[model samples]
Target: MEARVMICAQTFFHRFFMINNIAQQPSSVPAGPKRAGEPEHTPHHMMVAVACLFLAAKVEEYPKFLDDVVRFTYHFRHGKEATEALMADKEGALKVEKDRVLTCERLVVSNMGFDLHVTSPHCKLGPVVDAVLEVAAAEGRTDLVREHKSLLSLATNFLNDSMHHLICLQHRPTRMAAIALAMAEKFMVGKEKIKPFPRVKVDGEMVPWWCSMRIVDDDEAISSDMMRRYMKDFHSQVYRQDDDEAIS
Candidate 1:
């Protein structure tokens, strides 16, 4: 069974690998005159956000339905909740904000040259996980390593969707990778989901039942915090390192 699963996975990756080579690169902001107070960005970073969606659909093979993308992008940019949110709010009558939606779509299309296809980081993330697992095995940390591998995969899946509207993919991968790994390790240590840890009631607030676990001690938390901090600090280091090497 394991061998069959592995073979299937390999075949899937091989197909994706061939397609990934020719498809568009990841979505990026397009170049434009820098706004006041904006840091200068590379041409690649400046590709319009809409282009990112184009890339995602092509790469993930799951394009956001056109209407859904336009509606969500407008709602997201304008801070207008869709009908569902307005229905939930009893304060005022809900009307479909057609003008706002139309304007947003036009702006996005104009900025992105109406191109909706692009490459996605998801294509590259698999190899990264494999490398992480290899390192984990070398260090004899199988328990924590396996947990981390799962966390990375989950985080990557989540980001594949989130990247549609985002400019930076750096932060999510780092922060989520750490958080997921920590949670996984907590689960592995006899802190079974069956006997959850005790929850202290904070005044007027209900903590979720699942979050009541005593996952990390204070000392361990410090290490975890340091790991997170390192990821945060290192987020843009890759870009900078490449620039430095180019100059050299």
Candidate 2:
């Protein structure tokens, strides 16, 4: 019964939260400064508050930590604000007591669980390349298909250690494949590299700059049906442009 409740909660919350995220306008830029007249407990405040909460969850068995308030400060200031801003609001009037911050952090932890990690296209490069290959095969674009496959492998290799920055936790195989595919499409269609090829310390390793049309069949393999489901789910859950229309 507890397990069932957990599953149900996750499903309902995931649906609503994803829909809400979709409804918001997509911004390539980092979040902007808050309006001057924004209220104390406004959504922006809640966003900062939620970061504190997630930090508390990370420390406790729950989902946040007391120190997350400082983390929020770092994010807000982008390492530019004075330390005093860590204690009070921008106007220096609304002070956040440490105890209150801890309490809110606990509240956030209870709400979000300790699962802070999320999936991105970095994870799905493999399957996306294969999917593109299938599409390429259908189009009879052998050169383009092979090019995409090569790019897919290169992107996946580039991400091996960098995935830590993308998700911050252990890799989930299914999500990894989806992210890989999306990345492959981005490169193949855009005809550009998303990031510089990662430097290798090992004596013998393939480098993206030196290689062309190198085939990696194992990289194309998807592990399970669940992985495919996760890939599609993550794409739908996270990457829609028109939030209101994207959720449905």
Backbone clashes in model 2: 23
Model 2, 67-134: lDDT tens per residue? 54555545564454544455456433223434444444444445555453434334345554564455
Error of 2 at 187 (Å): 3.2
The RMSD of every model to the true structure, in order and in angstroms, is 18.0, 14.0
Off by over 4 Å in 1: 1-103, 114-117, 138-140, 153-248
Q: For candidate 1, what is the TM-score? A: 0.31
Provide TM-scores for the models.
0.31, 0.34
The numbered model that scores best in lDDT is: 2
User: Cα deviation of 37 in candidate 1 (Å)?
Assistant: 30
> For residues 87-189, could you state the per-residue lDDT of candidate 1 as single tens digits?
4543332223332233334444444455444333444444444544554466575554546555565545444333332222333333333333333333434
Which residue window of length 10 is worst by lDDT in model 2?
Answer: 208-217
Q: For candidate 2, what is the TM-score?
A: 0.34
